[model samples]
Target: MDIETCLDSRIIHIKSDIELIDVKGQFISLAAPIRLTGQLRLTDDLRQILACIDNEVEKLTLQIGVDEAGRGPLLGSVNVAAAILPSAWSGLIEMQTLVNTPLSILTDSKQLSEKKRDKLYPLVQQNALGYVVAEIPAAVIDQINILQATMLGMRLCTEALLVAVAEQIANDTSSTSYNLQAQVLFDGNRCPELDYLKLSSFGISESSIDCQAWVKGDARHTSIAAASILAKVSRDQTMYHLDSLHPQYSIAKHKGYPTRVHMEAIKMYGVLPEHRRSFAPVRRVLENK
Candidate 1:
């Protein structure tokens, strides 16, 4: 259901009182919406999406969720974050709607279409608060291993939020600083550092490391979805910017991930400074070409 939900250029909407009988059934407005499957499926409209979201948010008043994106891809970085809402959650939703984004599609990061991401990138940027993203360069990934890299990235994102919230509060930059806290909810059980570094690294700081990993975090977790959007938009923008330097390779097309376009670029141009020679495909290309 989360996978199929549209997030690119289509705003999902259902009436306040309309009872959603099924996907194909009428989206007739009613007095009170019937909640089914913990999610509502309906048309693409701002008010409708907001209502559905509000229904979800209203149920889970206080909780933090975490998720990751861009892991399978060979290029760019692994991105993740932990998020919890303040009293401003409603305002955040309203601000998301008011961001002049008609096709404001918010869903799991990879679920979004390329066109939709390009369109709503700015909106996500405009609306997100206490957002964090970590760019795990190829070198670090090679050294630490992918699993550890992923965990490290998530940890960094959480720390980033803590840092930002602390910064804002210290300087009184804005009202969002008060909401920052150490509590976190991750999507999986195993932490790379927890297994790798264990409690040894935390020392006295163990109490500050409060997070739990879940099974299908990005799908069911709102904070994870929020993190997913933050990471997705950030990495996409990075790809767009890098496209300028590697125009012939079409970095923007593959977004630094290994694709036919990227492979061909490697074969044609050899390795550039940013190319991850540590990757087998990149190494093979160098060996063969």
Candidate 2:
């Protein structure tokens, strides 16, 4: 069901002796629910529901979050990042405590200042079980278009991170076997197809994969916010490096956005190799040149 539908569903009050039924008709017995009052409190509720499902499979889940940056930029690569957060808990109380920490302060990368994102960059990496950042360059974006390239980048980031996590587990256990579950979340209205992903190859259960596209997920989910920070910081760092090499473009000022200064730079200094020729602003400039 969609978020609206899920929100419209009746809120259940958990009691030690009473049984609660979820939307899927699953009967769950809870001593108490993690009651955090807010519209976004549903995030905690969803985590509890997923925990219930994970209990049925008897597997520890890895929450994988994916987000992207620079998709709308007129130059440079679109960077995507995937972050993995472990969901190992003794009980619902422990799980609630783990998730309700300072991490909840994280929000969309665009909403944060550059200084804040830079500060959180290392913190996110340190907290995550594993993460991978992938980029689709402007040239490749020109070949396949921004949307397809973004999907491809996100897929690559998720695949690479999963493989890395699996490898780490195998090294720690001295065996290439595991029963990890994955709950993959994307920070947008639509996610790339996950059905074709080879769960077995990653030592995860095929049926245990719960891939969802959550709108405004960066604001609601800590994992998605962490991924957004990585992507945004990485892309911004790239732009800064590019600026150092070519100061005339003023890439560091606008970060390749189609702003008045950026457009004027393109018209005056002409298109660079990193400029997205497929974009209308750069295309118009190139056509005139």
Candidate 3:
């Protein structure tokens, strides 16, 4: 039996009883068939392993991932981020490896401690080929509503990322034309429809881009996870600053969420400009006053 494996550079062929398998400048000997629980499963197992490796290698390419933070916060701004990773990056980093570690810890920011998120924030930014973060303040959220605000933020971030990519291509001294065919992976079930008129300034057409929204994308997708970290960290910093200005609200502790302490502070001190007036809790407080 003959099995063929496809890789980025070449195709490897393995024949049954052949002593050697060469893949990507590496050679593996298949002369000794290993017995697993007294069952011989060398050929099938080896093939599966090689196929999985190929799949992973294929996924390590240029792509964009987007996610948002602070949508649920009653105060502070909503932050949306879009991250572009180079074609050489393997999308395998997770939140668990973000602390005092070299591996990129890419995962949903909520799953990571604040310290870990802070640690990974710079790493993500440094490794990213291009990245952009957009914030929609409380006043904007109140006017446009949270959902629209979030979508608008996403669009702006994406537009900025594309502009960055274009600039990088222009600056590259290499003669190779950078034809970046990126697929946008949004961390949700729905993405805001692109406004062609608004996107015209970025020179990006709707048809030229391929985008898809996935459920739990931040947890499942590496790029989305990185974007999650960027968005969360940026929003957290904003909340911390707001906390400094309004120490009574403890914005840093709850990060502007409608926590018990946050609600109590609203009742006692009234609302601040950072508080979203359209939010149920803030609106109720306004009604009572």
Candidate 4:
């Protein structure tokens, strides 16, 4: 019997005498059975079947998730993080499974307390397949605008992550040689225009990497969650350092966010170089002065 297949988004529709297997979020239909005398062969339809299989493979392939912190802050730098987890390791790590000592918990960084995030930062760095943290300071944010600066930070971190992955493959003798073609999942709807790096020595083409944007990806994807934790902790540490220089701003307490205390502090201490002049409150203060 001749078989026909159609796919709509995540759903797959098939018509054939053979019973079709059910897949989650996919629908399949079977047509009337037809007896055949010899081995059945698929000609033109083979291409379609192969295409569907390829789609499935891509869906299951590894992904590098990117996220940012300090974008909305009135002070400090914006931190972007790109992280890729080892395919062999699941997202969850048992309390004492890793290392001899107990480690911090893993989840969306926003869900964790400051102490918890501080502990998990080192654990994430140790276990990540490859990760990069890129920061764009307030001066740069003021010059290029926050949105553009954020996109730039994400692009830089992603490129760094690719470099790290390449280096890891070169250094690990036990690692099997494989083509790199992982999708980058951006946390927000906007995806940065990332340039491809051609590793001529390794014979890797520019098309090896793919990019995708997923809204609220940090909450939905494990890799994005990992990236979030790294970015947040790094930015917080930077804010703490800044606080040492300008103790009046109390940056460590508010972490540069525009809380009531922060606003009052800004009014009393005035603007500093670390404050984002492009932000409305800072801009207003500058304009008034």
List the candidates' TM-scores in order. Answer: 0.59, 0.72, 0.71, 0.69
lDDT by residue (tens digit), candidate 1, 211-258: 666566555554555666666776677677778877988987787778
For every candidate in turn, the CA RMSD to the true structure comes to 17.4, 15.8, 19.4, 19.3
Compose the digit string of candidate 4's lDDT tens values, residues 1-289. 2222222321111122222212233433322111111111122221122122321232224467789998888998888887766543323343222333333356668888998999888777666655667667777677768897788778766755554444434433233444556578888998987644334344244566678787877666777877898899988988999989998888889999999989898888898888898899989988887
Kindly indicate the candidate among 1 and 2 with the higher lDDT: 2
Worst 10 residues of 2 by lDDT: 33-42
lDDT of 3: 0.65
When 3 and 4 are scored with lDDT, the better candidate is: 3
Name the top TM-score candidate.
2
CA lDDT of each prediction against the hidden true structure: 0.49, 0.65, 0.65, 0.64
Task: Report residue 248 deviation for candidate 3 (angstroms).
Answer: 1.2
Q: Kindly report which residue pairs in candidate 3 clash with one another.
A: none
> Candidate 3, which segments miss by more than 4 Å at Cα?
1-61, 90-101, 170-180, 197-203
In each prediction, how many residue pairs overlap at the backbone (N, C-alpha, C within less than 3 A)?
A: 14, 0, 0, 0
Candidate 4 ranges with C-alpha deviation above 4 Å: 1-62, 90-104, 167-178, 197-206
Name the better of 2 and 4 by lDDT. Answer: 2
* Residue 1 C-alpha lDDT in model 2: 7
Over 1-289, each residue of candidate 3 has an lDDT whose tens digit, in order, gives: 2334344422232222323323334554432321100011123222222122311222112377899998998997888888765434535454343444353555678889999999988887656655677666787678768997788667666655554443433333232332344578888999866555544444455565788897888887777888898889988988889888999888889998889999999999999977899999999999999
Backbone clashes in candidate 4 total: 0
